[model samples]
Target: MPQLQSHTIRYANPILPGFYPDPSIVRAEDYFYLVCSSFEYFPGVPIFRSRDLIHWEQIGNVLDRISQLDLTDQKNSDGIYAPALRYHEGTFYMITTAVRGIGNFYVTATNPAGPWSDPIRIPYGGIDPSLFFDDDGKVYVTAQQGADYNSHAIQYEIDITTGEALSEPQVVWHGDGGPWTEGPHLYKINGLYYMMSASGGTAKEHREIIGRSDRPYGPFERYPDPILTHRHLNHPIQYLGHADLVEDHHGEWWAVFLGVRLTKDRYSVLGRETFLAPVVWNDGWPHIDNNEGTVSLDMAVQRLPLTAPSTPENHAAIVLGRDDFNEELGPQWLFVRNPSDRACSLTEKPGFLTLYGEETGLGEVGQITFVGRRQQHLHASFTACMSFIPVSDGEEAGLCIRRDEDAHYELGVRRSGGRNVIFARLTVRRESLIVYENETKAEQLLLHIESTEKEYKLACSEDGQNWLSLGSGSARAISPEDFVHKMCFTGAVVGLYATGNGQASKTPARFDWFEYEI
Candidate 1:
């Protein structure tokens, strides 16, 4: 991965890296703020602020509290969906549908960082809700109610304070009769109300289309062709669509959307990332990627003074790197659901992160003891130095590369029979299989997984240098396409985990350091 300096005049594409999808962005004066969907991952709706569109810094997460979001009964990949970010007057409003927890809601805050309002459930149906503030002091909420080509979008005026409908929901357009018409955003430019949306399912044929109307609703004239896409692009960027447009301080039009890096065999394990491309308006219709209809790894745009804002080392430093557990956990770390302060601790054992070994979960019915971060690269290696001793046959602690609970691979050290051993397990939905096992004499072990675009290779080492291959599995086995029971919407993650099978354990697994590399 080529690195870009924060102070560089020119920046690279994918200004926002990792699994950031369904981007809703806006420019407030010289600053730009963006938000993305978090799915079932906790601390949902990650919010980022950028002085220029190039260097974005994650300020905070919207649903950072349990009272604001509840995903207890939600299945894997069934939580927060697309979110729309908008700033009006002195308020910043974030509107979206929490797919499984709550239906439609919006949160607000004056400052992007703290004390965001809890979910204000709006009496709306469907997913991917967006908010648009018209010049006439009217606020509109729009959403897609159907799936695939049957999907139709409707908009209604809403009172932002109480989430109350001010007008009846009305269907504006059917979106060019495209497959999976969704992700609608409204913008008024040149006295015309334009509705930009994503059509075609979020797979290979995804595209961004634009339609305009004289009024806020009804009889929108949809452009015959998509404004942005990469279905035919030979570049590494794929799954392109779901765009939001904004104008910079220099009056230059820009569009931010989501796209995945196509690795080997067109496999994308890092998930959808936010990409930046210039928008050129041609006879009132905006063009993306410099009017080239596609985006690439690098983009050309005007710099924003390149103000030196102390940022993390790199993309890997922000989302894909080593953790010595010396300081507080940053925004990169995530938990399954609502977490407590007792879940992960560094002060418990000096520099090591001690995860309290949770009692076993029977058939995904109990709490899981783990802390993970999203896998944000096509080829990634995650290694951890862990020391744990199982109290009983059920206790285990090791590394796991998970897509969801339904599909995942785990390599852990546990006590089986009478001797301590290392095991590799592959699970699809509820079915589990022990792919590899070996007796070990190491008390403190180095557990790792070399994840590539097409395969996941499990490896272990008694010491950091002497590595042993445990087993290998297809990368698709842990992808959204491999779910056996139901469909999946989230990407893969690698983390440290400890569980006691079904029984309670007071022991904790200590991890000295966790490192990641390309």
Candidate 2:
């Protein structure tokens, strides 16, 4: 086999930020296809492609049209969990779980970069879904299924031509040693079928486990121990689990899994993030990076050949941290649920994007109806200029650093009494929207959020000068557990938004410019 001379982890600075979790990858010809979990964000399952895994570009999303999936009455962080992307017989398929309305749905496209078909619901009950096509064209699906509170590893044989299960699903394994075991991928190599899954809970202690079976559906046997884990790191950010395996052109294998790095206090506000490690087969089993069950911050081997260098410049083009909503939402932006064209309008505002206040507050409406990008990096500045007039009291518009509706820091203008007030609020959910009043007053406000490795400080300025500190609150950096939902999938996007008390007929906010720098 032709071997890649060098393989290195390039693009360590988050290819996609904010809430992109459980990435599944496939290669076609010279380009590599990748997809990530969108959660409540609409236009769910962003699809990206790369000639070299180091430089990725967003082509489109798998779930673009609302008819493609169900997002009616969905809440924040409540839809579309983990998605798996695969290609076979000149067609690309993405199977995902729509947690709220549809259970597991599959969409297909002639091209990985696509005009994908509407989601066809699979009667199977599961969360993280994976698809496999065998050499003889036998199709199968593996997922985490069980009762509402308990989970079991299940698999079913299916007909690929029609997304129908040929056999009833059977529980091949149950999560015992670990709290929850899910996200399974079945790969066949050298007549051996391998099952890789995420075990433990999706928290700081998550890990990836491996099992094997000669048949697609069988009495699979788990390796005596975990193939990869974060158990050794002293109070390390939750590690291991939620993994997908792929082999490059040269026949070298690698695994892309989610993990997190923590700040001093063991906080990972950013959520779980994607990490890569080399996979080597040993004694009829697979191990990570030279038979070591764990990965180090640095590796000395290559899984793929490195490309030649291009022309040098003052700096790499500022690929991340900039957005022109003129086009479709960049990979950096995320919504609470699947998005629709009608939820927002760049055409109505022209040169600006307008997000109409939905009936649901930031806590609900996870779809494209209430979209927010992620906040990554320790030291960064988020600024946005918007123009809006609140219609009634309790209506607000401006910038926010959000986890869910309950946990966030927002600085905006609200209709308090009859006057517009500049206010800042910390949301801890079920508790009061902790309000902080700014001494300086203004009708229209320019919102700014700044963060260091420790805390977040929010401020506002009228003429871009003489800033007033609305308030300062503690901030946590990104880690594997939080990385899944904290940051936007593409990258941290500093954008504009508007939300009201849900009583007004309609409230609109216009954003002039949104900028972020690290």
Candidate 3:
């Protein structure tokens, strides 16, 4: 346990912005590593590295290959959950659960940027799995059990190499019971074991609670109140829980956690972003946010003497650069579920991304030839310059903004009645609507979704300069609950897509560039 003293070097909130939820961090000597869940997206958990917590670079993904993870039959937002990243001895361990298919698993690597080992499935039947290495050389695994989202957790010592339980699985601790006590992490401070868990749901009311025990698995004593929360603050950033504490090389403690950026109306498009806060040791327990017990938009910390990677930013927000298809895919690019080799390719054309139109469309239970990146900002403009000549009326190519499979809005271009036309389509679960349409003849056009804080305006441009408004809709229609009738843990993603309705179309949709900005 360590205390923090305020210093210079200002940094904006959300060290890692956009759809990076359930954050867990660990420090090893001079470097700090963090990982976040990927849900149904391929490349299960994204990993980052930094000398200072303010600036981070994506080194690699924990599950980047089909062998590491497979979300083949996963539901809309049901894939990987919370991950615990820790460094012990000379090995780095990442323990988590792939919800739909394989249950709990742990992967290891000597370097954070991997070539990580294949999934080592743990037979334990729980989610949000975490691990703690004790000074006695024994390791313990903790996870949330029971069927409901409000289920408590259980703990047991286990062998990380063999996945064998050294002791019987025992119900260890239940948090300050508001709801689900999940996202467990254990630490030893001053010879006392401190356990942390998240509760009160992962919505606006999310919170973090701490407890103490003499040993890893024990009858722990719960803290009287939440150590960190934004529940009653009436701020735009809510759902502040699921955190991991790490000590810096300076012996100062800091916390990295997940929080959503809610709009004025409390609707979130950036599902949950990773945020950092300073920690101070009170007696023995780590007290975050001084005595105020609330994480703010900005924090003061010790500035490490290290250079940060250049980040693209304007006064509005961070900018995701245009993908011109002149190089390989960036780390931000992702597919709906596990992507097929036939879905898309960059080498087919020198400066274009050729998306082979698939039969399955968005929000379907099957895979599609859609690749997207997480929509990071609320008020943003997303445009894709695409060229596709539909052989049949069923073939189409366009820009899509998806909440999940069941909930999404698409502004598409297709061949209709021997004429090229643009159409606006919206789907909320079983309900679907083609809200607007207009005729166009250009083989290459720019499809645009200009999103305000409250609404989205769909339009197109013959050239990148002149724009035509297709239609506009309220942002609430495409939120989590509207798509799948559940609180979707994921967020919205925007990118280019192509489909043949339900038939195979060998004619590919080529995208010259895809730009998303705030």
lDDT of 3 by residue, 43-123 (tens): 778888877777777777889998989888688779899999999998999999988778999999998889899988877
> Compared with the true structure, what per-residue lDDT tens digits does model 2 show for residues 53-126?
55566787888777876667755455678899999878899998987767887999997767898877776856
How does residue 227 of candidate 3 score in lDDT? 82
Q: In model 3, how large is the Cα lDDT of residue 507?
A: 77
- The candidate maximizing TM-score is 3
lDDT of 1 at 168: 88
Residue lDDT tens for model 1, 1-518:
95443233455667766778898998776689999888877888888888766777777888889888887756677789999999999888998888767799998998888689988888865898889888888989988888877897888998888989988898876887778888888889889999988988887888889889889895788888888887866767877899999987756688989988766666666678888887878988998842254466655454444345555535422555578888877776777766556667878898898986666342373357778887877677999999987757777888998787777788978877877788998886668888888887778989899987778999888867888888888887776656687766677878888877766556788999999888
Candidate 3 lDDT score at position 427: 74
Consecutive 10-residue window with the lowest summed lDDT within model 1 = 2-11
Report model 3's TM-score to 2 decimal places. Answer: 0.93
Model 1 vs. true fold: TM: 0.91
Candidate number that wins on lDDT, 1 or 2: 1
Q: Could you tell me the lDDT of residue 13 within candidate 1?
A: 63
How far residue 513's Cα lies from its native spot in candidate 1, in Å, is 1.7
Poorest 10 consecutive residues of model 3 by lDDT? 310-319
Candidate 3 Cα errors over 4 Å, as ranges = 1-6, 148-150, 289-294, 301-319, 416-419, 481-484
Q: List the residue pairs that clash in candidate 3.
A: 363-405
Candidate ranking under TM-score, highest first, comes to 3, 1, 2
